[model samples]
Target chain A: MPAVTVRDLTRRFGPFLAVDHVSFDVEQGEIFGFLGSNGAGKSTTIRMLCGLLKPSSGTATVGGIDVGRDPEGVKRRIGYMSQRFSLYELLTVEENITFFGGLYGLDDRTLAERRAFALDMAGLKGRERTLTRDLAGGWRQRLALGCAILHEPRILFLDEPTGGVDPVSRRQFWLLINRLSESGVTVFVTTHYLDEAEHCHRLALMHSGRIAALGTVSELKNVFAKRAVVEVRTASPMEAVRALDDLPSVEKTSLFGTALHVWLRPGQRATEPLRERLDGLGIHAESLEFVQPSLEDVFMDVVERAGGTAA
Target chain B: MRRLLFLIRKEFQELRRNPRMFPVIFVAPVVQLAILGYAATTDVKNVPIVVVDADRSPVSRDLIGKFEGSPYFSVVDVTSNDGDVQREIESRRAWMALTIPPGYGDAIRNRRPVTVQIVADGSDSNSAGVGLAYASSLIAEKAAEIALQRRPPGAPTIGSIEARIRVWFNPQLLSQHFMVPGVLALLLMVITTVLGAMSVVREKELGTLEQLNVTPLKRWELTVGKLLPFGVIGIIDVLLVVAVAVLWFEIPLRGSFPLLFGLSLVYLLCTLGLGLFVSTISQSQQQAMMTAVFFFMFPMIYLSGFIFPIENMPAPIRPFTYLIPLRYYLVIVRGIFLKGVGLEAFWKDALLMLGWGVGVLMLATFRSKKTLG
Candidate 1:
């Protein structure tokens, strides 16, 4: 059974379609990754599912609860952490958790249990008495993640949860998400970090107003059908981009500082002939390591194809 | 009901958790009360003035001595030339200058009509008027005394001809005594209204309020929760200000303390409710503060019979003054403190405050819901 289901969900701010015909589903206890370009309707969709916003049209059900018919129950079943930091900065970690617990309608006994569980999970047991403002960014993010799931909510919605956290904290936050998913909590999250999508059980790439691609990491790479990513380091970055734009089997190309990452067609072997071609032009390219297409490459391929994917 | 409890509990937690803002919430009103109550006064005495007595005669000297003898005037400078008097008035060294022409004393002794030029600064009308009246009344009393001394025996005295006027309630008309009680009412408003005005705006800025809203908390629960903490602070501020009034200003609280507290609690509900109402509409704390200042500060101070005498206002404005809560509060405070009158004269004030409380609270709750919606 699906833990979350959204159908033909349309949300608008006046005439601007924030989320247009957005539809998706989260399998029970699955880590569903919602991917989108900025302003591509990810948070708007999450808000509708969580009952924070009433959709302009269509329907949503979370944990078998309808967003339209049973908003209050939907609120009780799901937890939301907004893109902007939402914890009480002035309150200490323990107090913040307890306050949220109270709002979630957990009894005092359950509240204590959840507090202890959350504190231990976040690895901030002794620092529970510390005010959230006093905590560093990483700890605060971890604490916020802890607070979001303290009620053991059936489904958790994280809106760009790791936008500004250090990489190490992001790792810990994902670890907690994985733990919760294993414990039967459905995790629906939106993030701009392409690499983070690799950790997701499945990814949905939304662009313009709808999902352009939806599949597992391997499936997404397969959909892109790219054999490998090869770095072309040349004297001039733009020269490589100009050279690769017309290159055969060049699935997608983007600049990373002075290096060029080329996405070649699937099963197209990386041969010395490519270097020979560059050498003939006197390009004197640096190391060309044939790497597998990461979610970054896959995301680019999907977003680029989004222009043509509407049909 | 359960969600309301949750919201209320959350509000209380936020209020407690924010240790830094706690002082602003609880202590600021008391401090403002203490400072404003003491500094805000209407009594005018010892107005410094330069006396330019050009007439170098015994009567001119005696008239200047009489001014120095009066408590209302402290003759700072005794100048002989007319230009010196202008200089004194120009420099603000004297709010007023009394000029006696060269022939003034000669004319008074010869029974010729004498004129003494009395000039006063008109900048600050209240204290200026007070000073002018005090000085002029004293001189008129002296004029009457002289007239009596010169009157033929068995003739009717002007004092007997004019009935003696008595001022009730405030006999001496000590501005401090009158203003201090009004100051207490004003202080209560500052605490209660400001607290309410900041509450919703704080929640919006803080983001915790969004959390509460997403929960199952009903509108009434949210309203009550947001109001309770500030309401408590308002009551505490009332007690603190009244204590200062009773002790420091010696302004008696002859009315029942419990009555004042109970009424203040109702008044605070309206005030704090208004604060929440302001918060709901305002996008930021700065806007909320400014809006509260403009709306509450002026009305409470000017229209509330706080700084001005309500009865003395124009007849049209007089009816409008009846709508200001402070008018009723002043009556209640004075009736209790000065007149030692209790509920007999105050039940009307109590009902007015109660109606305002319920009416404002309902509007606030409805508006808060609409804003969120």
Candidate 2:
């Protein structure tokens, strides 16, 4: 059985549906990523999967326990870390680890063993006495993760864990996540960064409380976004993008820094249509060529096609 | 049980580490004890008296000496002229004026009734009335002494009825004895309710509530764990207040210590439960504090008859005092402190407190569970 199986789960706050009929499955020991914008219901879905919230309709099971029926059973098998720092800032690093460990009913012997493992994993081994608030942002994030995993649950849910950390720290955190997955722990994480999503074994892109796409990164790139993207380098990038906006062959135009990224529909040749349009408008076109579509390109195309309504 | 202990231990650790809360938890109680001990009182003391001795005899001197010796009376001035007596009282130097008539010495020798005038400032009637009563009792004692000296040995006293008043507990009727225990109730309310709400709401603010909810800890265990530390603080506060009341304020704790401690523990559940209920309804620590003050603390303090007498309250509002847990607690504490009553006499109040504690805690626990869900 999958580590998590969510079938048509829905959660409503009053009249607003925060998670609407969303369904997905996460394989055991697989690193599953949920990607979306700020209010795209990623946290809501994760909360339900972690048994912190009860779904308004449908059902979900985490670690073979029904979330709606035996949420406490699901709770015993999963660990969750929120986007914000959730450990007691006034407590020492070791104290935080022990508190959470005890909450999971770990005995003293097992707690001591896990404490050593967690401290080493967080690179907070020697700073056991240091207050959590005194630690730097990256160190605090790592310590929070360490505390969450002290009980060594079968599954872990991280809701935007590396939100504000520096790039180097972000990469290190990802390495820790990869290690956890490699050790047979099913990891479900959410992030807005497309690069982080690429590291996941399989991911679901959510938009307006609905799953827009769910597949491997390469599969999404091949399936939803099959059209080629024309990268335009021009002296006047704004005028070049504006000139390409009205072209019959150009599907969409997006400006990335000083370059213009133009999407062409299937069976449309970007070489002839793009050059003719820009030359007619007297815009300086330095270069134009077809490029492989990134995950970001697939996401933008899917969300736009999904109609981007408010949840 | 071990999980609850760990959670409680963690709570104390956090409390100890917080620099701002250190003085609040420890030092504030002592300072408040000192302030409330001396300032809150109704026992009359040091009533300044002006004696106008027109007779200037030995008898008049004895009367002056009597007023000077009493702890309740301070003889501010002595003059032969009645006008000086009035001047002394009108100038606010004295609260009462005792005037001896011209024949006051002769009348006392003959065992006759002499009407000595005692003038008191009526503007502040409470203290002035008590002062006059003290003066009358002293003079009456002196007259009884003279009559005894003049009477024949073993002769029957002429047609008189002597009524002796033996005041039982708190003979002096010192207000500190009353207010010290009352202040303890107020202190416990502030700590358990306000601080309790702050503790719970603070977890929500820090987003730790989300982390806690995902743990295997049961809901009631979590609630009890979050509240057990404050309950310990409440017990410590009770002990501190009791020590201050007995040692510093000199108010005797005549009842059973175990009884007082046990009853206080039950009462704490009501306050802490109220605190949890406040946090459930509030979204932030500030909101929790305000709700604890306005919604929980104010109504409980007012209707508990801590500062006001329940009987004197309006007919419409009097019955609501029964719903206040502090009302039953105050009765129990005061009974244990002054009257030395035990479970036999106050078993009903104890039962009511238990009922209120269980009822409030269950409701709060339900509300918190719903809020979390």
lDDT of 2 by residue, B57-155 (tens): 998899889889999999988888888876787889998999988889898877788888999999889898899889999999887877888889999
Backbone clash tally for model 1?
A: 2
- Local accuracy by lDDT, each model: 0.77, 0.86
Interface RMSD of each: 3.2, 1.9
How do the residues B1-373 of candidate 1 rate in per-residue lDDT, one tens digit apiece?
Answer: 5545655666676677666667775677667766766677666778998888889898888888888998888999988888987788789988988888999777877778777888888887776788888777767776676677777899887654544779866677766667777777777776667767777777778776666655666667778877776677676778777787788877766668887777767767666766777777788889988988897677767977777777777887777766667778788877777777888888988788778778878888887641221
Among residues 3 or more apart in sequence or in different chains, the pairs in candidate 1 whose N, CA or C atoms overlap within 3 Å are B196-B275, B197-B275
The candidate maximizing DockQ is: 2
Per-prediction share of native contacts kept: 0.42, 0.77
DockQ of each: 0.37, 0.53
The weakest ten consecutive residues by lDDT in model 1 chain B span: B364-373
lDDT winner: 2
CA deviation > 4 Å runs, candidate 1: A226-237, A247-252, A256-259, A263-273, A287-291, A308-311, B1-27, B49-65, B77-84, B97-117, B150-160, B310-331, B339-352, B369-373
